[model samples]
Target: MNLFDRLLLFILSVVALVLGVAVVLVGAAVPIGWAQMELTRHPYNIVTMVVGGVTALIAIRFLFFRRRRDPKLDSVMVAGDHGPIRIAYDTIVQLANRRGSQLKGVASFETVVRQGQGGLVLTLHMRVLPDIDVAALAKEAQNAVKSYLEETTHVPVERVLVQVTELGDNNRSMRVWSGTGA
Candidate 1:
């Protein structure tokens, strides 16, 4: 949460606690030296005090509570012959890039790997050369990356998603402008 939100919550909790304690004291027939009233004489005063005290306690507890976050999983563990082996995500990305760069019509690419239940999921964001079939390029990239990662890392690939981001002019021939209206 943001600082402003935290500050607001803290202020509200303090207010709730003060009001709750005053209500409870008054319900128990104890005089609240500041405010003089007959709230304790009511038949439902006990119920009101109970609700108020619970609300205040809850607010107090929440004021000190913090949410827990899970640590990031950056490496995958594989059982080796001697012991367990850890494969870093950077290594997988490098392997994926190697495989993708080898494909024709692929100008540049970026790969992301996510650990899944069955296996690893690879997503490739690519910039391909102009005048090429995007569908074919995507299919080729998916197959190449999936097979390459599986063979090299010995990890099963559940899915390979290919996103053709842009058309690159890296393979185009250079042209010179004549400045005139030629």
Candidate 2:
């Protein structure tokens, strides 16, 4: 997917292949050890070594040179030491922001989170482009929020309440964020 993921996969492939070859070699060595034989007697040893080197080289290329990359988000929603849910409120806010930003016509949005007026309610102050489908966007965001938070954090998100805060023209607001730049 992403650069990090591709590299990880490459490293794992190399390791697994090496381990597999090693096992075969060790298995062959046991019988030879009993019979007092040498590696030169086994013609397949050369082929095995060559294949192992080629496999390692290919893995290295995938790990270092491939261009297409995806974002590797390992951590999403882990719970807190002392909270109603293991997941912190900030975590929910982050999921809301990510979901809102992913929507097609969202301009920008700010999160104003508060303790649930009902039960574990999340509210988003989303600014959107004027021409967007408001209802469909809300539905999409809600679904994404629910799916991501549940899978990553292992927490049940009861409600994602969204409010259309404003229609953004996109000049000044785009340059600023609720907090410092990443």
Best candidate according to TM-score: 1
lDDT of 2 at 119: 37
Q: Model 1: runs farther than 4 Å from truth?
A: 1-72, 171-182
Candidate 2 pairs with clashing backbones: 2-70, 77-153, 79-86, 80-86
**RMSDs, each prediction?**
10.8, 15.4
Specify the highest-lDDT model's number: 1
lDDT of 2 by residue, 1-182 (tens): 66698777877877866765675565455564543454556655545556666665665555466554332222223456875334456666786677668766677765645444343556777777766678887788777766776676666557778888888674555533333345
Model 1 lDDT per residue over 18-72, tens place = 8888888777765554223444355466587798889789778867867563323
Q: Residue 177 deviation, candidate 1, in Å?
A: 24
TM-score of each: 0.57, 0.43
**What local distance difference test score does each model get?**
0.81, 0.63
